[model samples]
Target: MRKITLSNGDTVEVECLSCALTSGLIESDGGVVIETDYLHAHQAVAYRIE
Candidate 1:
């Protein structure tokens, strides 16, 4: 598992599944749900925000 902090202070925790695929969720204090295969693939979960 890994945490990726965006330039806007948004966090994305993900895990490497393949070459260019990752699995995780998006954590934004600004109340937004950003979805992308870049952080969620192969049905893997590795992120949380609360």
Candidate 2:
């Protein structure tokens, strides 16, 4: 896994291969996941981490 600190002071962990396939943003307690077209054509549930 790879880690990054967002401008909002949130930490994100991304799988190496999936990094390019996903975008993310920090939420209140966790974060939201943005899936790539290959993952979903429609808006799917955003992944959350605690």
Candidate 3:
């Protein structure tokens, strides 16, 4: 991951979520639910604002 500073002086970690998922850097729950020659869809239970 990489960190970037925003204009408000907030530094946040950055990463390519899509790339991570596809490349297996991040594992998707239940694996990929859908896929095609040009697309892929998977279940990702991530951060939740509740």
Candidate 4:
């Protein structure tokens, strides 16, 4: 599994071998956008721990 830290300090775990479409909210310099990817592609999940 791979991890990606968002600008808002959120960490997401991505599976390289998964085949399922996932959805998550992303915060970028331009603004916030909803990110989605196919099941076959790498997926990212963002969530706050605290």
TM-score of each: 0.29, 0.31, 0.53, 0.31
**Model 3: per-residue Cα lDDT over 13-44, one tens digit each:** 54966676677665554579988889989764
lDDT of 2 by residue, 1-50 (tens): 76755444656675642343243332323333444555523222233334
Whole-model alpha-carbon lDDT for candidate 4: 0.39
Candidate 2 to native Cα RMSD, angstroms? 8.8
Give the TM-score ranking, best first: 3, 2, 4, 1
Q: Residue-wise lDDT of candidate 1 within 1-50, one digit each (tens)?
A: 76765545555555632322321234333432344645422332234334
**Displacement of the residue 23 alpha carbon in candidate 1, Å:** 9.5
Model 4: worst 10 consecutive residues (lDDT sum): 16-25
Ten contiguous residues minimizing lDDT sum, candidate 3: 5-14
Each candidate's number of clashing pairs is: 0, 0, 0, 2
Error of 2 at 27 (Å): 7.6
lDDT of each: 0.40, 0.41, 0.60, 0.39
lDDT measured at residue 1 in model 4 versus the true structure, 0 to 100: 67
Models ranked on lDDT: 3, 2, 1, 4
Q: Among all windows of ten consecutive residues in candidate 1, which has the lowest summed lDDT?
A: 16-25
**RMSD of model 4 against the true structure:** 8.8
Q: Over the stretch 2-44, how does candidate 4's per-residue lDDT look in tens digits?
A: 7766545656566631221223233333332344452223223
